[model samples]
Target: MYGFTIVENLQKIDQDIKRQELKYHQKRVMVSKEFSFDAAHHLHCYEGKCKNLHGHTYKVIFGISGFVDDIGLVIDFGEIKKIWKEQIEIHLDHRYLNDTLPNMNTTAENMVVWIYEKMEESLESDQKDCRVEFVKLYETPTSFAEARREWMTHE
Candidate 1:
């Protein structure tokens, strides 16, 4: 059987580790965050069930990559949430997609790209060294559309 042992002393910042040692590596890293929103919309000029007015609880995932800062952190997860809430989710959560989004089909494919662009733009505006690596938007539990940096930048 395995045994558990209690700690004898807590590691103090200055006593156990120096401030200069806070950052342990210089390698670039990727961090991701997921968010969900519910919105209503209907596709234009399409002969399908989705053409009818409908709604979906959408899920979006963002993968951002960059070199770590002094603390060995790529980007704070809370910063990602703040960016999503203030810059992206404001136009998405509980709103009419057809009205809020730019003129487009409102399909997962289109939305994923738009979401990726928005995140990229936000990061650029903040002058953050990080870049959006990819974005995945799920229209359904089993159906998702993805936008990758290579495809966006190369094309």
Candidate 2:
């Protein structure tokens, strides 16, 4: 069995490690973040129960890729959260999907693409060489729709 051990000494910058050693490699990497929100929506011209207004605790996952910066960071989790909160989630969380989102059917498939685009748009303005790799929007725990970078770029 593994035993817990307390840290004895914290490495000091410039003494134990140099600033040049902060970045470990020069390779592209991907980071992911997931967030959840609750919203109500009704599908248009649908032939199912979803035609009526219903609510779901939706989940969204983002995959972003880029070359790491000097500090071995591709993008900080907090920065991703900030982008989600400020640019994307504002139009999503707790808002009526049919009204808040751009005119669409409000389906997970559509939403995922919208999310990918929004993140890409934000990254273009804020991050250097960072791009959205994929976005998965979950309408239910077992159901989701995904948008990928290749798919987006080709079309």
lDDT of each: 0.94, 0.95
lDDT of 2: 0.95
Prediction RMSDs, each to the true structure: 1.5, 1.1
Per-residue lDDT of model 2, residues 1-155, tens digit only:
99998989898898999988999999999999999999999999999999999999999999999999998999999999999999999998998999999999999999999999999999999999889999999999999999999999974
Using TM-score, give the best candidate's number. Answer: 2
- Please give the clash total of every predicted structure, in order: 0, 0
> Candidate 2 has which clashing residue pairs, if any?
none
Model number with the top lDDT = 2
Per-residue lDDT tens digits for candidate 1, residues 84-138, read 9999999999999999999999999999999999999999988468999999999
